[model samples]
Target chain A: MPKIAVVTSAFFIASLISVPMGPTSVHLLLPGIVGVLLGPAAFLSIAVGLILQCFLFQFGGITALGANALMMGVPALICAALFRVLQNGDRRRVVWSGALAGGLGTALAAIFLALFLATAGDNFFAVAKLALAAHVPVVIIETLVSAMVVSFLFRVKPELLSLPRREDAVAVKEKLEAEAKESESSS
Target chain B: MNTALSWPESLLVLAVLLAPLLLPLLYFILYRRGRREGLVAPIVSLAEMAGGDSFFHRWHTGLKVGCLLITCFLFVTLRTIPGCLAGLAIAALAVTVSGLSWRRSLARLAAMSGFLTLLIVMLPFSGVMQADEKSFSLAFLPAALPLRLSGLHTASLIVFKAMAIALLMEPMLATASLAATLRGFRQIGVPVALTQMILLCHRYIFVFQQEAARMWRGMRVRGFTARGDWASLTAIGNFLGMLFVSSFERTQRVYEAMLCRGFTGEMPEIGSEPIKRHDIGKAVFWLILAVAPLVAERFLHDFTQFFHK
Candidate 1:
């Protein structure tokens, strides 16, 4: 229960801190940063964060919430996976990986947005193209921000990056100990 | 070939289509610059209003949510101007039935004015093959830039569809407690664990926001202001790192506390009333009301065809 509460709270609070990008309604959606920090749990966090955004902030509608979640959550999950594969504990490597993940996530989301719009009909193809074009600056901005956030976390709290591995080791250890105790009792 | 709109038409388009969305931007700027109220004001306000007692508040969360879902489908798929207008009227009717003020509902639309404004301004110029006759090629511009009238019409339609749903959301979302709403989601076949997580996440968001704000304030006192430099970026990054470290440790403690209280893998269900028959009836009635525009559009189109015959 506490695990559920804390993970949910961290991501939700993270999303609540959205900074509106100048004249446009496009706000900073920090899915990449959340993904880098939360690891495998990034998808769940993104989905929950989006739901909160839909209901509270009116950032997206309830009906389209699932599509929005899929768009944002998939990138976060991919970012988490990429971080795990790419990082070798070097600060520069982690920063680069974070930047890549952040930019990639936004780009994929823009594509997803276009695809959703395209589903409206053939006439929306142009609008979809424009949407993707508009997100280019967002991609760059997110890359910079994600890099900073990931680098900072790596330097200050390297443990966050390796949480999944740590948990897996603990679980394996617990299973091994239990198996050994059972064998001894049988003997 | 004649695509140019006179000055009067351009002005009319700007006034009728583009102006209303600016009000919310004004509100957003005032809020951001004035009280420094932090970012959670909108979230907090909607959450508070969801607990209000009204007709909508009386309906079961599941029923209201179900209706909202249907309305979304209907509005998003709707293609005609009259259909979209009908959808907006239905949304307004729902808001009235919920006993919420039009002003409050409009304010909800206002929150999204920024987004709507963007669509109105950008979609016409998105480079879709414009219907030549319908293009609003402005004569006033030296280059005679053609604003695709069809694109503008589509953008307007999309905005109206969005506004209709946006207005309807207040009744659907704000009319119940968050717990019941989550429970409704669960009842509607969403995983129990997922709903539980959403609730937990919502509670923690407030917790973490306060902590983050305090830390931010502390940094400010120490002369930290974000600038476009590596130092500023690094400082911001460190702040985020510290926040994660502190929060991660807190999660461990929170978990330990839960275990001490005899928590297992599953959360205990929060109390909610069973769905009554009337709840189902109410949901169906509202569903019909919400989808009336689609039906009206189909009938109206056929009706017009019969006249031509």
Candidate 2:
């Protein structure tokens, strides 16, 4: 539960990091990374963030809050599933899968946004298409960014990804034994 | 040959389009200046909005939230342009009664301006023109292209409806502190776990944002600019990885502290006073306001029927 809180905080912080996209800078939602980290809890985290965004910045209005939540939250959940399927034992494969899930998560979100707008009526088809088209670059950037982040975490902390590595377990056991021996000797 | 708007017409269109964006900017300046001169204490955080002794703040949050939700749904149900205009008026009245400023109300509208503008601009061009509908063309545009007048009406109605609901949101949710608001949600049947998560996340967002800012400054000093290139993406990835790594470590420490302090996976309830009779009366008042648009639209329906006869 505390992990949920901390990961939610990280999600917000990631959004603060704006990656330049042409003349304008765009904040990466980082939903994919969040999904991979939090698994099913990603929806809860995204909903919390959206609720805060609605109240604090008023980006998504209250009436549309549920719709916004559904759009983003659903994508994050899907990203979690995608990550699970894409990941294998190979470190390089883990990075690729994470990157793919990140990019696909964004693409799916754009689709959801389009679908939400299209619900307005047939008159919104063009606008929906435009919105979807606009997100293409975002998807690319998020994929690249997620790939790098995943690789870095893989190197520094394999535990985050719950990698099944015998070496890491042995290292932890050895360290614990060393600590135990030292405490016993001192006593 | 395509018919085109004269300079005056084009300018008028531009002015009409820019009004939503510009009006907010205008009032934002005046509001800030007034705040600086002590019109009211400047907002430190969104939760602080519940601090004032206004009627909205004093009212039962559950009732307030329920009424506002109903009001928003009613706003969406308004079909006619005049009906939506009335809805907007009701929203304005609500804002005034709640003692919120033009800055806040207009800021809500501004947040929605981009999408609303897109809908307004594209709907006319996107939809098929009926025989009764009117359309006009601009110079250099294809003759086959038509801008349906009916589409414009629906689009603007959407704009008015959206504005009405957006304007009401702050007074609805922000009239109570975060805890009280969540408690209201709890009263209205939001799950306890969800509320706890929301409260926890909201608190941690502020903490982590400061840490992120500090780290971002360090990166800036090292000459990192988000150029959207490969190097920048790699740097941002590493940065996020580091942040998450720290967060995971913090998670363990935070959990340990909570466990040590006797956490049982349940947060104590954020207590709220029982709903008063006057709170019910206020709810009824809001209910009436919510139905006002529907009633007016009915009257409009009859008047049009009579005129057509």
DockQ (Cα-based) per candidate? 0.36, 0.43
Write the residue-wise lDDT of candidate 2 on A96-181 in tens digits. 98898889889999999999888877888898998899789899889998999999988888767767555766788899999999
Estimate, for each residue in B1-309, the C-alpha lDDT of model 1 and write its tens digit.
445668898677767667756667655555445655443343464566665677688888877777787787889888777889889888888788787655556566777786677778767665546343455666555435567666677787878898888888778777777788877777778888778877777777778888888887887789876554567656765666676778788999888887898888778876877788988888888887877888887878764342222
Chain A TM-scores, candidates in order: 0.77, 0.85
Model 1 Cα shift for residue B96 (angstroms): 3.2
Model 1 misplaced regions, further than 4 Å? A1-5, A18-27, A118-126, A163-187, B1-3, B23-42, B101-107, B127-133, B142-144, B302-309
CA lDDT, every prediction?
0.73, 0.77
**How far out, in Å, is residue A29 in model 1?**
2.0
Steric overlap count per candidate: 2, 0
Record all residue pairs in model 1 with backbone atoms less than 3 Å apart, i.e. clashing: A8-B201, B50-B174
Poorest stretch of ten by lDDT in candidate 2 chain B: B35-44
Q: Which candidate has the highest DockQ of all?
A: 2
User: In TM-score terms, which candidate is top?
Assistant: 2
- Pick by lDDT: which candidate is best? 2
